[model samples]
Target: MPAAGSGLYVGLMSGTSLDGIDAVLVDFSSGTPRLAASHHVPFADPVRAEALALCAPGADEIDRAARLSNALAQLYAEAVAATLARAGVPAAEVEAIGCHGQTVRHRPDAGYSVQLVNAALLAELAGVRVVADFRSRDLAAGGQGAPLVPAFHAAVFRDAREHRVVVNLGGIANVTDLPPLGTVRGFDTGPANILLDAWAARHLGEPFDRAGRWAASGSADEPLLCEMLADPYFAARPPKSTGRERFDLAWLERHGVATRRPQDVQATLAELTARTVAEAIARECPGAAAVCVCGGGARNDDLMARLARLAAPVKVTSTAALGVDPEWVEAMAFAWLARQALLGRPGNLPEATGARGPRVLGAIYPA
Candidate 1:
């Protein structure tokens, strides 16, 4: 059990989409963390431009990374304040803040995963101990250092009688399979909104295709989807991880779809995501009772439809049905991770992330 009077904590996360920061206020006590409130703060145009620019492969990457880190830290601090203000909580009442930071590149196989964050600045601005850099230690330990949320998912969403697969379709789609009574397994299935968003922004002049209406309006190009699936990443065994580096715009262009219509490409990308995710689940946990979709992809009706069709025999539903809002699931996972860090608990499951062994994750920066 946690010591008495261990105050509250706030967790901040910015995913691959470069969309915004998600902050959640959590109360940690007696070994469990409960969500108190959550907030989403969209990125300003200049900040977004800077962040996107930093993702390029070129010189001065490290220098640009440093600048972006401090900028993102300020944004995280602001998000924390906003969340606390809306929750009617005082900063002094909080114990710490957990920030996942912005992932510019995640290559655990190379023994490091970079998540740009300024912990010192976050601590100074938030006036609380900040736990950040959660994935490096696991990678250093020869693990994929990803899908870290499965441990938290097992803790919060596991059911005693039914086996469940929790699929988080953020920029990259990942699924965590939790059986009624056994070890859980998880991995990045493939591209999710990243490709679709990029395609939409390029062709439709929008950040994302709302409700996947654009995709639904077009038809999937089966040849393009097949070419995409041929990428060895999908066929490789579990405990793997990927980012925009592998499945971004360049990758789409290389897959023989240059002349295809934008909506058709979106449709094919959405299908690829759904098919890869379902294939992973079918290969890993064929008996999964239902697939619970989460992350931003849950809002895409066309993606959901494709997932439903791909799932076929398996039913599909959102994490909301299991008491977790799809939008806040990742943020909540980080909050739970912070709680685990405080308890000196193992946050990564070896079976899920292919770690050498169970290990406690994250570094703590004092307030």
Candidate 2:
């Protein structure tokens, strides 16, 4: 059944995956949120290439980033239109749109993170108020300005009856531990699909290791996995986060991954993702009752199988089993953030993002 509401909102997300834009129409008139409709608009190859290029040194980056931001807004607008159409809902009914533009680079320690998007352009194109740039304020308040969805996860997925750990496996993997009685704590576990996808693209000419089949074909290089698991970032204390800046293709090559068989490397990368995530849960939320995963990694069977094995004795399932689809949970988070901003509530969890206190996130662009 479709979500029903007196007022609706839309969420647009282009995550670190660089896959595309995911737009969701949400009905929040009810005390709890519900998904109404969704649409995914993929980036054209040129746009995707340019966005990736901007991640590292390149010529004309200032001008190129500007152009890419405009292009992203256009795509976001199209997604919003498609979502509204799918729901048979009109723009006039939507109170606002929350958009988490594609993240090109993240360097929280330096006190800055950039998720490139033109919110004003999106408002103009979609003809609706837009709330975006959701991390800056958290950074200003001394936070990582990332892994912002833990607050949303706690609000929606937490089982008052037991402790729950929500793990999101995007390009980077992050974990949110919601204990039965305490402030939520979440942080990036370590590299997830970012390395696996990059390796697959380089060796197999594919976007990702679909269902981790390529990885399943080979065995993990245990030594390499041990070395990667030993990295300081893996053991980094909470309130920390990382991104393309720290774990990119360059980092992988420097770690001697290029010398191995491509399939073995893929298997090792899969193990690395699972190991780091499982470790983070054990380290941060000991005695966690169940693990609920979201994000692109949830679909990778090979990776999921490994995580289940590593997290034995503790139940593991996707957020879908809890109510929301795994792929769109992060997108829904931004939608919820937009509502928070409109209502003057804090969106960042001080414990999760390591902020001094709760902070209302996002900048609003008027229609």
| Residue-wise C-alpha lDDT for candidate 2, range 195-294, written one tens digit per residue | 9989999999988999999999999999988887777998879988998888989888877987889899999999999988888898889979899999
lDDT against the true structure, per candidate, is 0.86, 0.89
- lDDT tens per residue, model 1, 273-350: 999999999998878999999999999999999999989789999998987688988987887787678779988988
Task: Give the clash count for each candidate.
Answer: 0, 0
lDDT of 1 at 61: 86
Candidate 1 achieves a global lDDT of 0.86
Model 2 residue pairs with clashes: none
What are the TM-scores, per candidate, against the unseen true structure? 0.96, 0.97
Q: What is the lDDT of candidate 2?
A: 0.89
Error of 1 at 256 (Å): 2.3
The parts of candidate 1 lying over 4 Å away from their true place are 1-7, 30-33
